[model samples]
Structures are given as structure tokens and as C-alpha cells.
Target: MSNLDQARVASRSTETTRAALIKAATSVFAEYGYDGGSVRLITQRAMANQAAVNYHFGGKDGLYREVLIAATRAFEENAFLDPEELDALSPEDALRRYLHQFLLPLVKRDRVSRFLRIFAWESVQPSEVFSAFIANSPPRIFRLAERVVRRFLPHDASAEAVTFAMLWLAQQPMFFVRDAERLAQPPFSLKFDEDALERLVDTLAGLSLRGLSGV
Candidate 1:
């Protein structure tokens, strides 16, 4: 219609194309990984021009980097509790909620799944790209957990002792997710359903409280 309306339409079109590229690239990187995933494949999947990748994202590496960041942000928003939420909870309750949120991504199977896949690939192959991101991104959840755990520990406990306690609490779910595939099958046959997850949070919280009191 008018010049201003045409400019607005063009801006919306650019954003749509960029989002499509990122979405398609995420799947490509997840399936074939960075080295194996090509610009042509990503563009074809996005239904955007090949030149659009370079124009919008600099190149394939940059696009993959963006995908990783977007995936992580989604997980953070889904799984991380705000400081206010923790403030409203008691020490034990906070710990339980934190653990529950931390484990949510494993069961949700959304964008975070692709993120986890790419992360696993990077862990085995040692990519500079992922390494840089990890180095830059401080583990915010660790700090939150540490604060909650401090209330359970003795007043005289050392910082190192508190850190070790937090590590113990955090490691349970981390290792569980890593071994989930095997645990899902026969023999163990664990299912992380809603009821199971509630029990899991309760059990872990109880163990942590007992263990912390002993320390």
C-alpha cells in the first residue's frame, strides 16, 4: 500500500526468512552435525536462497552457533527457576523445584533435544565452537543450587564443602539423563512419567537433606 507499509512488510519478510533458516539449520545440524551438514542442504530445507545464509548468518559455522545459542536459551527459559521463585521456597522446597526444573528438558523433547544431540557430538569430537560457548556461559544453575544448599549445611562448613554438596545434588539428574536410553529398556525399565518424576524429586530432596545434615 503506502511506502511505510511496504517497509514494514519487507521487515517482517526478512525476519520470517531468518527464523526459517535457523529452524531448518537446527534440524540439519542435529541430524548430520556441523561438519556433515552443508549450506546447500540447510538452504534447501529452509526453502530460502543459498545466499541468504551468508547474508543473514555470515556462514554455516555462524548459523550453527546461532542454533546452539537459541536451543540453550529455550532450555534456560523452560528449566531455570527465577530468583524470586527460589526466594519464596524453603531450602528443601527450593532444592526440589530446582531439580525438577533441571530435569524437565530431558523429558520435554523439544528444541532442547536437538541441542542435546549437538552437545553430545561436541563432547565426543571437541569442537572449538561449542567449547567457546561453554567457556563463556557460566553455569547459573550451580550458583542457585549452591545458595539453596547452604541453608542445609552446618554454619561452620567450608565453601569447598558446600560446593561438593551442591555437586553431589546436581550430578544425580545429570548422570540419570545421560544413561536414560539404557535405563528406559528392559531390566531397569525406568519411565520418567509425571508420577515417577514427583517421586524422584522427593527422593533426591530427602537424600540431599539427610546427607547435608550429616556433613
Candidate 2:
């Protein structure tokens, strides 16, 4: 084969290999947690050689970072939100948009939901990498919630109150969907469908506004 043809083939192979590694790592990390997952396991899952993990991702840490980056990029692209645009929207419109933007991606994409579950589990344990990730990305939904609440509520809402309300609002979707096993049992018995999710969002937004207003 010509040198140019070989180069093209090599580039394509590298890209394909990297994509497979990331996919494998995401699943492993999500199922096993960061501490439990290993490079060897991820490579085996990817159907690539044991050395492939190091070759494609440098190591487990690199693979973890890539998994996060890929998930966040998918979220940023598919979730569809702009803080400035949100600021311009009416309170109800902003709340509706924010809820859909944050929840729809996770609900529609099983991989994203799995990643989120992994993130939540890792975050509770605490680590330098997790801390840095939180510090850097933060949660846009909190700011979005606060802004929308402020638009319809008293300007003097306490930061604590706003934060609590925002956090609660953010948790509603994940808790209901991700933890559905518990939610579906006994007294809760809450079965969530698309319509139910919409109602939950609307109710949470209204509650946030009320809480912020001290009503």
C-alpha cells in the first residue's frame, strides 16, 4: 500500500479504537465505580488487547477523564441551554425549558443516565478528580433555577433557601427515575412516565417559586 493510504488507514483505526475504548470505559466505570473498575477490565470489555487501554487512553485515569469529557460534550450538545437566553425567558418558560433540558437527555439516553448514576456515586465518596470536575463544571441547573425563581419571587430570597430549592428541584428527576426501584415500592409507589415527569417538573418549579417567595 502507498504511504498516504497507510496513513489514512492508521488514522481511521486510531479513531475507531479510541471510540471503542471510551465506550467500554464508560460502562465499566458506571457499573463498577471508579475504584472498582480497572484498565484490564475495560480493555477486555472493548474486545481489544490488554495493552490497548494504555495505547488509546494512556491509562485508567485518562480513560476516566475521557469518559467524563465525552458525556459532558454529549450533554452540552443535546441538552440545549444558554444562560443568557434563559434569563430573557419568562419564569414559567424558563422553568419548563430548564427542566426539559436537564432531564430529557438523561431519560432519553440510557448511557447518560448510567454516567450520571456513576457520577453521583463517586461524588458522594469524594476525590481530588471529582472535586475538580465539580468545581470546573458546577451545575448550571442551580443557577438557572435561582434566576428563574428570582424573576418571580422576592429579590431578598436567602441564598440558602434558593440553593435548597434548586437542589431539591434538581434531585426530583434523578431520584424518581434513577431510584425508581425504591420509588415504585410500598407507600411511594410512584410510577413515572413522560406525562408524570412533566407534572413533576411543573410542580417542582412552582414549589421552588413558592419557597423562594417565603409563601
Best by TM-score: 2
lDDT of candidate 2 at residue 179, scale 0 to 100: 54
lDDT string, candidate 1, 144-204, tens digits: 6677788788889998999898777766665555456667899999998778878887887
Q: For each candidate, what is the lDDT?
A: 0.75, 0.68
Residue 184, candidate 2: Cα error in Å is 4.5
Q: Give the clashing residue pairs of candidate 2, or none.
A: none
Q: How many clashes in each candidate?
A: 0, 0
lDDT of 2: 0.68
